[model samples]
Target: MITKYLAILRMKYVEMFAYQLSTMVWMFGTMVQPLITMMVWMNIYPDQGESFVLYFVALIMVERLTSAWDVWEMDRQIREGTFSYQIVRPFHPIHWAIAENIVYKGLFLVVLVPCWIILALFIPSLRLHLSVTGWGLFLAALLLGAVIRFAMSFLFGILCFWMNKVTAIYAMFETVSLFLSGQIAPFSLLPPVVKQISTFFPYRYMIGFPLEILTGTANSHTLMIGFIGSFIWAVVLIVIISLLWNAGLKKNQAVGG
Candidate 1:
């Protein structure tokens, strides 16, 4: 199992770096949204005052580290009935997904980190201070966020077994998570009711809560609350996945191999 997992990681690593130019392209491509945010915030504060810089830098950190849409891969497999090979394999499909996630994110950082340094140089005024402990906590929160997002996305993808096409449904889920997760904007700036509602959902903890903690915007009480929130989401998602997978297996019908 360990060897198989390693092989998956190795293959993903090789695939990630397959084209060095493509790596640069994707890095710059992903930078657009964050850069646009920086521009808007910069315009809002010409002299580099206010939360613009903090928000901009925090977003930069967020985009550089974010992963997306392994659900598409899962759906493709399920749709084509190729997932049966995975069932017969010696490992869980989640391990393969984890390997792909790790390899791709690591590869992305190779491109992302340098852009961050360049961003700091170009906009030195927008630097967000990240202490070592701040960074440690931030990384933990981000990891937890990734796990939560992956579990949720994969769960939705598995739902394709019972749906017409889960891409649209998964997309809706992603969109909701994006807003509720605070990817589009800071939750603090959101309406009080919105914040209240987000707290009850896993969306906030998936990305927003972690980003808040990373930016040191969360007080100790909120941080503890966020930790508990993220924990519950992870556990609940795990249980949900267990139930969904068993049902998906029972209902699963195949076309070809």
Candidate 2:
């Protein structure tokens, strides 16, 4: 399995570099919204400008690290009948999606971490000072966030077997996630009701939980709750994706028959 994964990673690395320009463009494009939100928050509360800077900068890092694009990829592949190739492979198709994610996010980390270090030198607000435990917990939450997001995307991707426009549906989900996942603003700044409601949804776990940990806003109680919530959502999403994969394969076979 390790050998297979290594090979897949190599292939994905090559594929990623093949479109190096496009990948660079997309990675930087995702930064714009968070930066704009940072500026707006700075304007709204000029006194809290440093806080907003830290929160939004951390938001960009956490968001990119946890982001998933499998839904769109699988939607197009399944719709155009290319996904069948993956279905027939010796390994599960989800593994390929997972490999792609690992490769892409690795690229993101390579670029973004150094950028953060550089920015922190000039902008004190971009600096982070976490203890060993805090760093460990942040990494743990980030991994969980990535898993939940990938599972959620794959779940909707497989829905393409039954629906003609799964991407559109996933787009709506992303639109909601933008606000609920803390992409639009820090959870601290959101209304009380929104913060409460975000707790019940997977969106918060996907990006907000990790950022909360990194930004030092989450206290002991909040960390406890965030880890538990993220774990529960990650498990739930993975199980649902498994169940849906079987059902979708049956549907796909029926159509092919």
Candidate 3:
């Protein structure tokens, strides 16, 4: 399995760089929304402009690292009957999606880390003062965030077997996540009720939890709740995906055969 993953990673890396222009375009393009959001927050609280700058820049990094587009891919593939090919393959189709995410996110970190260091040199606010343990926790939370996002996407993607509007459904989920997942503003700035509500949903665990860890804003209690929330959601999503995968495959076979 490790050997197969390594080979898939290599193939995905080559495939990603094959469209160098598009990859570059996408990498830079994703920054626009976060940058714009940063500007808005800066304007809202001019006194805390520096803080807003750091938050949104980190937001861009976290967002790109955790973003998943499997729903769109699976939607088109299943709709076009191309997914049937993957279904018959020796390897599970989910592994291919996971490999693609690993390759793309690894590329993102390589590009973004340097850009962050460069920016930090000029913008003191971008500098992060984190201990070894803090960094480790942040990375772990980030990985969990990525898994939650990927699992959610794959769950919605598998729904394409039964529903033509899985992409639309997933879009709705993403739209809601923008507010709940801290894309619109820092979760701290949200109303008390909203913050409480967000805790119950996986949206906050997907992006907000890692950003909280990275920014060093989470208290011990908050950290405890965040990890617990993330773990529960991760387990729940995995269970759902496993159940659905079998049902989806059976449905696909019946329809295609």
Candidate 4:
């Protein structure tokens, strides 16, 4: 099983490498939004402490690592009947999406790491207060964040089995995520009501909570709350995805087979 997954990862890496230029272009596109947000915030809140820079830089990294565009791919496959090939495979189709997610991010990091180093060096104010323990916790939170984000996206993609237009559904998800996931701004900088509301949803855990840990903005209590919230959301999302996948499979078999 492990070997199969590794093969899938390698296959994805090779495919992505074959179109490295396009991959790099997409990486730049991803960077643009966060870079613009960082610049705007820096100018608007020039007096804000070093934490501001650290937070946004961490936000950029988290955004790059945790992003999942598999929904679009899955939607295309389902719509085009390409997904039928996966249905007959021994493994679940979702594994392909998961492998693609890992490969895409790993490849993008080859470019992202140097860019990050340059940003950190050129920007004197962007200081990270990272401890050994914090690094461990931050990685754990990041993994959980990635899983939650992937599950949410895959679940939405499964909607393609029933709906003819999944793009609008995905757009709505992205629209809400932009405001609630701290992609627009740090949760701390949001209005009080918005901040409180963000905490209640899984969106913050998807990106901002991990960024808070990485930037040393989250205290012990906040970290504990984040971990608990993230775990709950992860489990809930997993269950939801499983149920949706089964339902979608049945629907697909009924309609297409």
Clash totals for all models, in order?
0, 0, 0, 0
TM-scores for all candidates: the values are 0.88, 0.97, 0.97, 0.93
lDDT of 3 at 246: 94
How large an RMSD does model 3 have?
1.4
lDDT of 3 by residue, 116-228 (tens): 99999999998999899999989989999999999999999999888889888888999999989999999889988988899999999899999988888988998999999
Candidate 4 on 111-195: residue-level lDDT in tens?
A: 7778777877878756565889989999999999999999988888888889888878888888898899999988778998998
Candidate 3 deviant stretches above 4 angstroms: 253-257
Tell me the lDDT of model 3 at 226. Answer: 91
What lDDT does model 2 reach?
0.90
Return the top candidate by lDDT: 3
Model 2 C-alpha lDDT per residue in residues 1-257, reported as the tens digit of each score? 99999999999999999999999999999999999988999999999999889998898899899989999888778877888889999999888989999999999999999999999999998888899999999999999999999889889998888999888889999999988999888887899999899999999999999998899999999888899999999988888888888888989842331
Which residue pairs show backbone clashes in model 2?
A: none
Model 3 TM-score relative to the real fold:
0.97
Q: Which ranges of candidate 4 are over 4 A from the true structure? A: 253-257
Q: Which pairs of residues collide in model 4? A: none
Number of the candidate with higher TM-score, 1 or 3: 3
